[model samples]
Target: MTLALPPLVDHHCHGVLRRSPDADTFTSHLTESDAPAAPGTSFFDTQLGFAVRRWCPPLLGLDPHCPPERYLERRRELGADEATRRLLRASGTGTYLVDTGLPGDLTGPAELAELGGGEAHAIVRLESLAERTADASHGPEAFVEVLDHAVAAATRTAAGFKSIAAYRYGLGLDPEPPTAAEVHAAAARWLDGRTPGERLTDPVLLRHLLWSAVRTGLPLQLHTGFGDPDLRLDRCDPLLLTDFVRAVAPYGCPLVLLHGYPYHRHAAYLANVFTHVYADVGLALSHTGARAEAVLAEALELTPFGKLLYSSDAFGLPELYVVGARVFEEALTRLLDAWTASGAWSGPDGERVAHLLAAGNARRLYGLGPDPS
Candidate 1:
């Protein structure tokens, strides 16, 4: 029998766009590359593209595998509100822990929760908070105090904190918390180089923000593995974080490694050895599409079931929510079914593991109650 998972808890994700994107914009969201597709080639040819073509049409009252043009046309016809509502509801997500770091005209957590028929919580971005408060403060010492205040205020309501240090300066940062004088000096340099809306990339500042968040005793999510042009893929490996992980172990702060792709096995190994570390295959699964089974298998190879969590990492488009959910449910069900059939795991054990990965682990870590729905 096919094992159906319970409603999912997306422990890491972003909100949907506020407006319906034109066809080109929609296509851009499919892949991680910032550049447009090469001449004469459509983004529709990718695994994620084909998965959307095959899986999303039925939600819009069309047959599966319909042409991309037809799908986009149907999307435009229904408009953004209708499309988002339909797709998010269909995804069967019971909760969303949204990362509010990326700047975009997207819904906030409460709006997403209402639209998805679930609950939502915020994941404060450490860099964004620093940037927002930077211009307001004149001196580096004041900047440090302002950022600390901001983080403390955010921790009161936010479910967790996220850092894109991997994207900004790679994961090879010195794990030791910087001295006050070092942070003040780094802040002065960052302030001198500041352009309006520039991101916080100074390594010392990044380390300071991470240590500040760790002190909150809240879960800290770090972007790892593959991402856009902003990061060096080779430098984004979770293995590079081994020293930092070891450094933060005493605080009992949970470190969630997000979207570890080619390095997923490495992330799983960290989660295996480090009692405070957790890992997920979020962006990798949606982009890998039909190959999600292999990625999920690698993620599961060494990680304990209780250490795995679910996330779509879905951004601009709601179709991604549907696609991520479908592929995950399909891939996980097949793996568990095969294991149970082979007698490698009992049926009851398979069911329990499925639930753990789907929602239980997230609930336990975040201190969330049962979904109201």
Candidate 2:
């Protein structure tokens, strides 16, 4: 179905780099060399971005000799051009949020700005203190430095920072999994040090960071629901955030729930109940099997009007934008059709729904102009 909606916004995407043309050759070499599979996995799945943590090596065309920074640097050297821009436009994405690679890779932001030419919107990823060290024993001093650097980078680029309080396990620089004490310690450190107007890791950190941001009235985005399969499903349960939502009900700042995957219904429930919490239908109806019409209908039934935002989370392949947009349109068409047949919504209401789903909600939420361009 053709959707008569505003240009779609891919609020979360990582299209800053394209896969190398020599991916197959590189994969073969890696398999033949010392980089064996991380147990129980085949070489083919490894090459196809199956294992989340190890996925970046092939996509960035990294040689074992090169560090990740250098690999991303090579991607920047290739850069986004007219053909890449065409690919994005054809994919039906008008705006995207590009994670500026990892810490110290601000080149992604420059590349996106050059490519966009002020025609599209982009949000650059800033490094968080949590990403600084894999170990938590180093103390909060280093973390404080990382946060300062992140704020400085965001200030320099007119971009926002992305933070993560806890990954699969612990915090700190150690590759070893983090313990519960480490997680709590890291959270406490972030809460104590963060100032007003700083970008947060995600809404899960809201309870700790909210009071600080609320004191400063800075906006915060929360990564809700599912993301890379490496993450445990239970950790992403939206219901786990009920206490968090209740805690910050008093001091308000715009809280965007990123992803909202399997928990779309729950996310919508929170959106309906809280003025500050809004559900972003970023990766949900796209990467996940939740894109079916029935899922969309259920989400719309649960979601209040104007609480939904569009996002792509388009990392790896740029084609994800088109794939995601098509899915969004299909699901939305089914929802409107069902609503119309039941006399629950009319043509005008459908038009409004389309507008809200497309850009109206995001424009208002992010305080963006009518035309992001």
Candidate 3:
């Protein structure tokens, strides 16, 4: 009773590493922690690690559930370029919206699209743009002018905008857009003490960045819930976004909350009530691995059929592309099949909903579909 889905649209992901990873780097992809796993326990024993072993090895010419050493050895044998190409091409993903904001010598949007044999679009990260623009300004006024110009230009070409405010200032910041005077004050203070490559965590600037994206009439993606050590899970709750969601609902801008894990249901509740809110358990799905079925079932609890979208939120390792897609396919099949078999949902309707989650909703959000090629 497996439900077949269309080629996925990976709405959120990043470029694979340009260089081949060593054993530690390969294992690092198995978890969200910035630090290594506890001394005795290995990240390789986790669900993600096992999923990778099962899904990725065959793509590299090894059997399923291959040993880590054999997997790495085979990966190196094929070389990074060939390995990445094979993995992404085998993913069966129709479109990729890659976030290039992270620091890395990774492939760009064009390269990613080229490699995957599909359309690729960029998603601008607000904080990264602001920090770079701030480094070039002399005062708050100049900072505002420069940043405004930069963001406007970037927005014109980008399919959407993204924010990591949860990782920076948390989701509990003031929901209102800053006034001109307040913007000047915050910028002045931040600039006065700004250091080279200093991170932007000021609540004012983060909110300002979000509001700026809102003004662009583009879909806005916000990093919410589980992530690396930089985030406080308690502070990343989607419920904290109530004020912000209410303020922006009237603007008709799509507010997409990415990677809602432990609070996925909370995010779904927001999407259920707000016309403009949407939720995806992307990174959470890939990281959860074997347990992604229960996670996906929960994400579907309160979200409307139209407001839920799909993404991998996969980064760094190219193998994640394969693992993410496999896990998603399996999880959706198991959930939807059971529902249909029990007469809870019609088979036809279930198939349609599966398509919507696979790629239809994403196409509507980012204005993408029907490959020109």
> Candidate 2 residues 271-315, lDDT tens each?
888888777665656544333465566677677878877776655
Candidate 1, residues 185-291, lDDT tens digits: the string is 99999998687688888999999999999999999999999899989999999999999999999999999999999899999999999999999998999999999
TM-score of each: 0.98, 0.67, 0.98
Please tell me which predicted candidate would have the highest lDDT against the true structure: 1
Q: Write the per-residue lDDT of candidate 3 for residues 28-72, one digit (tens) a residue.
A: 878888898898888889989998989988888899988788989
Residue 211 Cα positional deviation in candidate 2, in Å, after optimal superposition: 5.2
- Give the RMSD in angstroms, all C-alphas superposed, for model 2: 9.7
> Which stretches of candidate 3 lie above 4 Å from their native place?
371-373
- For candidate 1, the clash count comes to 0
Candidate 3 residue pairs that clash: none
The candidate 1 region of ten consecutive residues with least summed lDDT is: 364-373
Give the TM-score (vs. native) of candidate 3: 0.98
Per-residue lDDT, model 1, residue 145, is 92
Give the higher-lDDT candidate: 1 or 2: 1
Model 1: residue 59 alpha-carbon error in angstroms: 0.5
